[model samples]
Target: MDVLQIVAIGLMATVLIGVLKSQRPELAVLLSVAVGVILFLLVLGKIGSIVDIITDLATRAGISMVYLGTIMKIIGIAYIAEFGAQICRDAGEGAVATKIEFAAKILIMVLAVPIVVAVLQSLLKLLG
Candidate 1:
């Protein structure tokens, strides 16, 4: 399975990172990022299928594509930000990781604003 492959790659990378950490810390960090990217790419295919399914459901529900798009963007930002933060943390840069997380939160909030407003409007309409 793909998850098994991902786990194996991750375990191998972890071992290599451990070995390289003492002699070549920089390379260890680079290896971490490379493995992360590789894993992300592997799962990227599944993401497309998931997006297609969600899109179909949204269409059937008569939901606006704009909101769906915004939600997808938010999820993307969250995942990307977390990925970046984890990389920073792996490199022993906790401060940088925190900043990355904060920035991601801000971006997610910005993306969610329109959805929140739309929901509020719908609620108001129902109440009225």
Candidate 2:
């Protein structure tokens, strides 16, 4: 879908959420979640194409697929964590959102270990 369509969906959702907040707070939260999911689904196709382009570029550069894959995983973790945190915030759970962010950071660090090891190994070889 186009940007205009996404903007329209967001505007409609915002209107509905504002109206429902006074009368049906729970429904307002649900509407927010639904809108977020729909928007994410709409952009999935674009994400796939971007991934393909990145992979192609990595191949042309003769970069190790392992490094490219780790980078992709890190990006995925960041996006997913942000999405979860936003949903938590929308539902008025700021504490939960903070926890989600903390966990995502740890996971990202774990994923970077391999890349760090490779760099360290290269440096050690140069010193020797």
Encode model 2's per-residue lDDT on 50-99: one tens digit a residue.
99999999999999999999999999999999998998898899999999
| Local distance difference test values of all predictions, in order | 0.94, 0.95
TM-score of 1: 0.93
- The segments of candidate 2 whose C-alpha lies over 4 angstroms from its true place after superposition are none
Q: Candidate 1 has which clashing residue pairs, if any?
A: none
lDDT for each residue of candidate 1 in 1-128, tens digit (9 for 90 to 100) = 88899999999999999999999999999999999999989998888899999999999999999989998999889999999999899899999999999999999999989889988999999999
Query: Which pairs of residues collide in model 2?
Result: none
